[model samples]
Target: MTEKALTIITQREDLPQLFGKRIENQAAIEEIITKIETESRSITFDIETKEGQATCRSLAAKIASAKSTLDKAGKARKDEYTVTADLIQVDRNLVKQRLQLLQDEVRQPLTELEQREKQRQAQHETKLAALGYLDVQDHDRIGSKFIKERIAFLENTVIDDSWEEYKSQALETKDNALRILRPEFERVKQREYEQAELARLRAEQVQREQQEREERIAQEATAKANADAERQAQQIAQESERKEREAKEREARLIAEKESAELRAKQQVIDAAKRERDAIEAERLEVERLEANRQANKKHRDAIFIQAKDDLMANGIDEETAKQVIKLIHVSKVSNVTIKF
Candidate 1:
């Protein structure tokens, strides 16, 4: 008996009879691969010849092509087969063992790093709390806000040298706070004393002004009273002077009336004496005139009588007889008339 050979090449319609079992699209894939092998034969070369370097490049390209086909075949095989529960469990256990081995390698070191970080944070907090407490106790020496800001700046330093630098900076801030504020206390106290003295002097000035105002008001009241009294005295003196002048005028008028009456009585007596002297002179002149006329008449009568007597004597009549006739009939009278017989 002779052995028959296996053939991979088949037609698409007879792939199930050639394999003696039912397969999925095997005959179609065989037909496509047979066409590629036949058409790609022109790319082959002899390794020992000059063109043999191209054979290395061709071998690399064939390897890449084979890797891509193997990946596709793996995906297709996974799709065609069903995974059992036991197989999935076995794969999960293998992944868990690898993860546990990696965690164990770093576990102790990670715990130590976490504990160290917690201790560093706690020590930094304790130092900051102590700084705040010192400022609250004596605010003049240490300022809380100043120290806190300095410490915060120090905390953000480089991570490799964080602890030692932060500690050194926090201690330096506390020392500087005490040095700056120690010398400012005396100046503030002296300023307060000067302000108190100025307030006292201003109060004294206001009291003196009030006293002077009261004295000026009193002096003005006294001056007004004196002026009113002087005006009243002047009015009384004027009234007295007017009454004295009127009394002197009345006395002078009475003395002038008495002198006028005495002059009128003396004039009446002198006029009566002049009238008596004129009457006596007129009576004496009348008596002298009457005596002179009587003497002349007597002389004339005597002469006429003597002449008549002489004529009688001469006519021879007796003188004694004629005398007797003259006596009887007054011859002087008869002769002027001639005697009639």
Candidate 2:
């Protein structure tokens, strides 16, 4: 017999009949299909035949092709709703330019302030050295009171230098403190920036991976849905075929039973007719046997009488005496007769 084609649809709620009974629920159909699939897989896995392998490969290829088509369709629909690449690129460029401008504006003023502070620091150091040299020269030339007075004047005149020296020392201390801390602080700042950049990259990578995973899952889901539909359609086709086969088998069985009954009836009729013929033959044989026995007895009796009469005539006896003797002789010999004559 040629095999019928099959198709399965996932959304269908009712399956075709199997053995005259309808399968109404998709869940039941699914369970049966699962079992069939499992059994088919097991059989395929166990078999070593080239044909079996080829059949399995063909089935797999068909499934793969169906999945690919579903995936393409899903992707097409998704593309219709998704954001455009050019818009994203434009937004990214704008943010990058703004950040660069902010960094340049902050760096320029800070550089100029640092350079002027360095010049003032050098000038203040030179003035302090000149005031100290002048103080030393005036110390040996005058009396103590005058020397003290000149010293006071010099000290007074050098107040600005001393102030400048103090200010320079303070500035040097501040600069030195800044010098010691700046590189380390900048290094910390750079590290913070690098850490932020690294974090941003990691976040972006995580997001991309998550998005990819979601897409893969969606594709798998769509393929599974299509496969389920195909399996259901196949199950429905199989059920319909099974029901048709069962109906044919049942009809054939009924026909066979009718033929068997008719044969039995014919055999009984033949046996009865044969019995009647046998009875008639037996009656005919019995009648023939009776007729033959009667004829034989009559012939025997006639021969016995004839023989007695001849014996009487030859012996020269009176008719009555001869007759009596013949009767006796006949009676005695009758018991020993061998032939009818």
Candidate 3:
């Protein structure tokens, strides 16, 4: 069956069309593509022979020529359509711009109303947030007194008709802010109390340590004083004992000297008595020795005289004359007239 060829339906005032119809050569281009595919299958390329290569190159030239023709035709047709499309786009842009202007003009009052409503809502939200605004930041650093003041201020704030439609919400926000602040206030107060209690405990501990140190020092002082007193007493006792011993030694030495002096005096008297007795004995012995020697001398002289007298009698000498001669010689009266005796 042969289908009818399509045609471009540009500039059609038919049925309020929004876009142009397809190009007129579209069906003919499809038939041409089918015919080219069937013909290309019949043309074989044998690159092993020179004639075959020449034939293949001739076929490639023909195909390239056909391709160039088809490209030019397609580009020309596309250019014609592009010019029409560009003109339509210009008209469309002009219509859209005019419609946009009309639309802005139509919505001006509503836009103003919407803007005013948005501003009113923003103002309402800002006022409501202001009612609940907690200016205290850094809860840990805030003091308990400041927290209390904030709570009091929040509790006393009035939610009146000035809030208008958001009065209830404002009141609720203030109450919620108070509820949050009151607990924080109590927590801060508790922390402060705990810190104060800890400080008090530390102070007590320091005072206790100081007291114990003082007591220990006092005890040490007392013990040292007692020790010093004991040592001093011992020293005094030892000194007293030493002095007493020294005095006793001195007394004993004095007594010994006195006894030695008396003994020496007695010995001197005994020595004097012995010397007198020895002198008397020596004098008596000397006198007795002298008397004995005188007697012996007299006996010897008488014997010698008798012997001489006997010899003289025998020789015609008298005993009385010999005795006279002996007496003269003994008295040292005769010079050369001594007897032999």
Compare the candidates by lDDT and give the number of the best one.
3
If ranked by TM-score, best first, what sequence of candidates would result? 3, 1, 2
Q: Report clash pairs, candidate 2.
A: 7-233, 8-233, 8-234, 9-233, 10-229
Best by TM-score: 3
Provide the TM-score for each candidate, comma-separated.
Answer: 0.24, 0.23, 0.40
Q: lDDT per residue, candidate 2, 1-341, as tens digits?
A: 00011113211233221111224622223333343234333432212455644554444443333233323333443345344333323322332343234323323344445567687776666654443322222223222344334334434542334455466554444444344343444454565678789989976875676556555655654565556555654655666577977656655655565556555545554555456547755776798799899978876776676576677677887656766666666557545533334
* Per-residue lDDT of model 3, residues 124-199, tens digit only: 8987766664544545566788778877777777889877788889889998888788888888789899999998
- The sequence of per-residue lDDT tens digits that candidate 1 reaches over residues 1-341 is 10010112212343222221224733223333334334343344454454554543443344334324433443333344434333323323322343233223323334455578688888876665444323222343334344445455444433234546466655555445434323223333354567678878965765565456545544544454444444544544565477867545543543353344334333333343334334544554565577666756655655555566677878887867765665555545554555322
In order, the Cα lDDT scores of the candidates are 0.44, 0.46, 0.57
Full ranking by lDDT: 3, 2, 1
Question: Model 1 misses residue 267 by how many Å?
Answer: 84
